[model samples]
Target chain A: MSGFEAATAVKRIGDGRYEADLDGDFGFAEALNGGYLMAVLDRAAVDASPHEHPISTAATFLRPAKPGRAELVVDTRKAGRTAATSLVGLVQDGRPVVEALITTGTLGAAAEPVFAGPAPAVPVPPLEECTSMLPDEGAEGFAGQVDMRFDRSTMGWLDGTPSGRPEIRAWFRLRDGYGPDAVSLALTVDALPPVALNLGSKGWAPTVELTWHMRAVPAPGWLAVHGTGRLLSDGWFDEEVEVWDSTGRLVAQSRQIARVGIGVRK
Target chain B: MSGFEAATAVKRIGDGRYEADLDGDFGFAEALNGGYLMAVLDRAAVDASPHEHPISTAATFLRPAKPGRAELVVDTRKAGRTAATSLVGLVQDGRPVVEALITTGTLGAAAEPVFAGPAPAVPVPPLEECTSMLPDEGAEGFAGQVDMRFDRSTMGWLDGTPSGRPEIRAWFRLRDGYGPDAVSLALTVDALPPVALNLGSKGWAPTVELTWHMRAVPAPGWLAVHGTGRLLSDGWFDEEVEVWDSTGRLVAQSRQIARVGIGVRK
Candidate 1:
C-alpha cells in the first residue's frame, strides 16, 4: 500500500473495535500529526456509523502519540435518520492517546449549493507564486505527503517580519494522488503551519484541542484554506480556519487553541 | 436554587452517570438551549474526571431536547497529568439528545501569563452604549437569563442594514448573581445572537453543532464577545466567537454552523 494508505488504513478487529498500524511517514518528532490521528479515528468512526461523511468532530489531544499499533474503540452514541454520532478513542499502550466525538452524515457528491457565498478575499495566486512550506532540505514525515502552497504575503514570519494580524491563507492538496475526501479534508483543515507563525511566533505551537466540521464534499482541485486567530494571549491562541473547495463550496470549518511557542510570545 | 442554578445543577445518580432536571428558564420555544445543554454536560464531565475545569467540549445536537429531564453518561477516555478526557451523552426519555467529548483540566485561577497578546481589535462600547439584544417587549426564556449588549455597528441587521459582512461584537454576562465559571463560559461562548443576523438574515438560527474551549478562568465581570462568520451560503452559515474577560484576558473561544432562519435565505 502507498504511504498515505498505510498510515490511514483501519481494520475492523471486532464489533465496534478497529485497529490501525501507525507508520512513521505521518509522524512529527516521534508523534503522529493531530490531523492524521483524527483521520485514523475518522476511518473507525465512519466504519461504525451508518453515515458516509463526518459532519462534526471534536478531538482532544491527551498526549503525544507515537507511531505504532493503535486501537480505536468506537461507541455509537446515536444512529438517526439525519446523522450518526460516535465516540472514538485512539488507544495505545493500554491508554487512549486521543478521543473524539464524531458526528457523521451523508452528503451527495454532486450536490450544488443553492446560493454559494463569495470566494474568500485575497485571491490565491498561481501555484508557482505560492511559497512551499516543506523544507528545502527535502520533505519528511507528514509534510512529505501533503502539498501546501502558502500565500507569500502571509509568510513574513520566516524573515522575522511579523504581520500584525494573525492569519494564513494557503492552497493545499494531498501529494499521494489520493483525491480529497472526508479524511483528506480532516488533514487539510489543520494542515496549515500554525497561524501564530505569521504573528511573529516561532517553533511548534502544539494544539491543545481542535473541533472541526465537514460541511460539504470538496470538489477535486486545490482547497483554499483561510485561517485567522481571534486572540493571542496568556500562553494561548485561538485559530479559526475555513476550507473552500475548488467549486466554491465551503467544505469545512475548524477552530483550535494552542500553546504559544517558546521565545515567541506575542 | 435560582433559575440559573436549577438549569445547570446536576446530580450524581451513579458512577459516570448524572442527571439534571431540564428547567424551562433555559428553554427556547419547546426546546432547550444548546449552550445550556452543554453547561449541564460540562458539569457532569468535570465531576466525573479529576480536573476542576472543563478545557474543551464539542457537542453535537442530534434532536431537540424538551424541558423536563435529561441524563449524562460520562466515559473517561483517558486521564493524564495535564488533561482528562471523556465522552458524554445527554439523554432524555431514553433517547440521546446531545453527544459531546469534553476535555477537563486544572487551570490555576491565580496563574500568571508569561506573555499575553493583544485583545481582539473591535473596541466594545460601554454597557450603556451597547444595544440590548433581549427584546424590549418582555424578557423570555434563555434571553432572560443572560445579558448580551451588541455593538451598534454590527447591529445593522436589526434594522435591515446588511453591513455586507457577517459579524457580531458584544458584551455578555449572566443575569443571575452567579459569576462566570467554566459552565457559564460555555453559555457565554454561544450566548451571542447568531452572526448571520448581520448578513441580512433574521429570526432564530439553530446551531447544528458547536465546539468550544475554556482557555482560562474568567474574572468576575462582563465578557467581551467578538464573533465573525466566514461563510453564509446555501442554507447554512458558520460562526466563530471569542470571549474575553473583563480583565482583557482571553477566556473562551467557540465555532458552530447553523441553518438559516425560517423565511431567511441568501
Candidate 2:
C-alpha cells in the first residue's frame, strides 16, 4: 500500500470485533483527516464480510484522533440473509475516538435490471493535458501518492479564477499501481474538494469536513469525479460530488462542508 | 392547512430565511421533525430566489429545537451573473439549531440538452391499496397526513414480516387541501421513511437524522417517492429517497439516518 496505505493496522480481537493503532501520517493537519478515518472504516467493513455486496457507511466526526497509535473495533449488530449491519469504532488508549455504521449485502434479484441516470456529459481531460493542482502547502505531504489533473473547469484556491457556479467537474486517478479497493477508491474520491473549489476560483481552500456515500462500488480502474458546490453563504459552503468509473458507471457520491475565507498558502 | 397549518405561519426573515415560534400545538417535535425542516428550508430557497434558476439544498442536523420559539435565517452567499448560493439556519433562543445551504441559478444557455439514465420503471400502486399494510404501531401519526401506495415488487416492514430485501418504492400525496409551496413540498417529501421501512419488517424504528437534496422543485400536486434502506451491520440504518413529480421529473432526493431497535414510541 503506497498511496493507499492503511494508517492503522486492523486486527480481529474477537467475533465481530477488531482493533488498530493510529499513525501520525493519517492526520491531514492537527487531527486525523475525515477521509483517512473513512478509509480505515471502509477496510474494516470489507474485512467483516468477504463476499461482494453493496456497502453504505456514514460517520460523524465526534473527536479528532491523536497521532502515534489508536485502536479500531468492529461489532456485528445484525446479519440477515440479504443484508448485514456492522458498527466500527476508532479508539486511542481505550477511549472511543470515532464511530461509524456500515451496511453490506448482495445485490437483490429483482426482475428489473439495473437503471442509472446517464453519466454527466462533461468531458474528461487527460492527466498530462491538465495542470497538477493540489494545495501548495499540503501538496508536499500528499505528493507522489495520489496524482491530480485539473481541466479548465477546475475551481478553488489553486487557481485565482472563480466561476461562481455551484457545480464543478474534474478528472482524477492514482499515481499508478494502486489496487482499486474500497479504501483506495475512497482516497481518490475524497480528495476532490480542493479541486472543486479551484474549479470555482483561482485559489486554494482546505476542506473542513466531508461525508461520502457509495451508490455502488467503482469498477477496477482510474476514476472520474464530478462535484457541485451549492449554498456557499455566511462563510460556509456544502458540495456534493458524484464519482464515475472509466466506463461511465455511477460509483460513489460524497458531500462536504467547508468554511471559506480569504487566505492563500504559497 | 391542517398538517401544514403550523408551517404556513412561519414568517420569512429575509433572502432565503424564515422563522416560526416553537410554541403552540405545533411544538419542538413538529419543528425539529425531519420532514418539516426539509420543507421549510426548501421553501426558503425558493423565496430567496424564484424560478429564474434551478436550485439544490442540503441540511445538517446540529441540535434539536426547543418547543417555545425559534427563528429561521437565510442568506445568499454567492449570487453571480448566473448561479446563486443561499444558506438557511434554524435558530432557537439565539442559539443555532439546524443549518442548511442552498444553491439555485439559471441553467446556462444549453449548447445541447443531456440527461443520464431513464427513471426506474417501478409500478405505482393505489394509495388505498397499501394503507392496510402499514405497521400497526405508530401508524396513526404517519398515515394521518400522507397517503402512500407501494410498488408490489419492493419489500417493507408492515404485515409483521421480517425485511426480505432492503429496498422500497411508494407513491405519496398530501391528505388534501395542502397548497404547494416549499413547506408543504418538504413535508410531503420527508414523510416517506416510515412507509419505506414498512417494507423492512414489522419492527419499529425512528429517524435520528435526515438530509435532502433537490435537483428541481416537484410539481405542485401529488408526488411519487422511491426509497431504499441499507441496513449496516451495526444496529443503525440509512434510507435514500427520491421524490418524483407526476410527470416523472426527478424532483428531490433525501437521506435519513436512524437507530434500528425494536420498541414502541413513548
Candidate 3:
C-alpha cells in the first residue's frame, strides 16, 4: 500500500466498527490535521456504506487528536438507493475526538458537469516558478507526506511581511504517489495552510467545523487548491477552498469556520 | 411568544431532552425547511448548553421532517468555558429525521469585525419596486409566515424565462415581527429560494447537508440574502448564502448541498 493508503487504513473489527492507527506522518508536530482526520473517518464511512464515493461530509472537530490507536464507530443513519448517510465518530482513549456526518454515493468516472459556474480566480505560475513549501533543513511529518508548491504572491507571511488579504493558492499532491480519488480529494481540499495566515496571524488556527463536498472524480496529477476567507471577526474566521484537478475541472469544495489563533494583528 | 418563537419552542422533558411541536407554518406544502429545522435544533442545543449563542452548526438531513410532535435528543459532546458542542437529534416516530452538530458560545453585542471581505454582489432594488413571492390568491404556509421580496432580475424563473444562472437574492424577514437574532439568522441564511431555481429545475429540491456559522449579532430588521451555486452536476448542486443585517454587516453565512430537483433543462 502507498504511504497515504497505509496511513489511513482501517481494520474492520465488527459491524459498523473499525480500528485504526493515528499515523503521525499526517500530523503537524503533535496534533493531526483536521483534513487528515477527516480522510480517515471518510474511509470508514465508505467501507460501511453501499455507495462508493463520499459525496458530502460535515465534520466537527471536538478536540485535537493525538497519534495513537483510535476506534471508529459508524452509526448508519439512513441507507438509500441513491445515497447513504452515516455518523462516523473517531474516538481515542474512550473520548470522542472528532465526529462527522458523511453522505456516500456513486460517482460515474465519466460524468460531466451539467452546469459549472466561474472557476476561482487563483491562477498559479508554472511548477518551476513556484516555491516548494518544504523546509530547507528537512521535511518531517505533514510536510514530508505531502508535496505542495505554493504561489509566491500568497507566501509573504513567511518573510514577516504578511499580506493583509486572506487567500492561499497552491498545487498539491501526495508524496507517496497516491493518485487523486474521492478519498484523496478529502485531503486535497484542505491541503493549503489556513487562510488566516495571510491575514497577519501567527500560530495554529484550529478548525471548529468544516463541510466539504465531492463534486466530481478528479483527473490524475497535481491538484490546484485555492483557499479564501470571507470574514475574520471576534477570534474566528471562515475559509472556502476549491480544489481543481489537472484537467481544470473543479473536483471538490470545502468551507470551514476556525479560530483565529494568537497574534492576529487585524 | 411570536409565531417563530412559539413554533420552535421546546419543552424540557429531562436532562438533555426536549419535546417540540413541528409547526406546519414553517413548511412548504408538506415538508419543512431545512433551516427552520436547524433553528429548532439550535434552540435545543442552546437550552442544553451553558452558552448564549449557537456559533456553528453542521446538519445532515436523513429524511424529510413533517409537522407534528417530535422529540429532540441533545447529547453533550464537549463543554468548555469558551464554547460547547453537542450532538442534537430530531426524532419523529422513533426515527431520526435530522442530526446536527451544534457549537455554542457567547457573542458580544457590540463586537466589530476585525476584517471582512467585499460583500456578495446581489444588489436589490427598493422594497416597493421588488415583487413579493406571496401568491396573488393569498399567502400561505412558508410564504405567509416569511416575507420575501425578490430582485426582478432573478425572478425570471417564475415566468419560465429561466435565467440560466444559479443564483437568488432577496430581502427576508418574518411576517410576524420576529426580530433578527442568532436563531432567526439560521433561518434567514437559508430563507432565499434554492439557487437551482434559475437553472430551470422544478419540484422540491431537498437539502442533504448544510453547515452554517453565525458571524455576529444581527441588528433587528430586514436581512439581505444572497445565494449562489458553484456547480450542479450528476443530480447534485451546492448553494452558498450570505445574510447581511440591516446595518450592512455580515451576520451569518451558510452552504448546503442538495439533490437537483426534477425538470432541469440544462
Model 1 interface Cα RMSD in Å: 3.8
Quantify all predictions' global Cα lDDT against the true fold.
0.81, 0.55, 0.89
- Candidate with top lDDT is 3
> What is every candidate's C-alpha DockQ against the true complex, given to 2 decimals?
0.37, 0.05, 0.82
What TM-score does chain A reach in every model? 0.94, 0.78, 0.97
DockQ of 2: 0.05
Q: What is the TM-score of chain B in candidate 1?
A: 0.93
Off by over 4 Å in 1: A108-125, A133-138, A152-165, A197-203, A247-249, A261-266, B108-126, B129-140, B150-165, B197-204
Give the per-residue lDDT digits (tens) of candidate 1, residues A1-266: 77676788999989999899987677678877888888899988988888898878888887788888988999887787767778788899997788887878787777655444567667777778998876673787777888889888888887888676688888898887786889878888888878888777878888878988888888889888998876665566778788988877789988887877667643
Tell me the deviation in Å of residue B191 in model 3: 1.9
Backbone clashes in candidate 2 total 46
Higher-scoring candidate on DockQ, 1 or 3: 3
Q: Which 10 residues in a row give candidate 1 chain A its minimum summed lDDT?
A: A111-120
| Candidate with better DockQ, 1 vs 2 | 1
Q: In lDDT terms, how accurate is model 1?
A: 0.81
Residues B108-128 of candidate 3: C-alpha lDDT, one tens digit per residue: 889888889998765767778
Give the Cα-based TM-score of candidate 2 against the true structure.
0.54
Worst 10 residues of 3 chain B by lDDT: B131-140
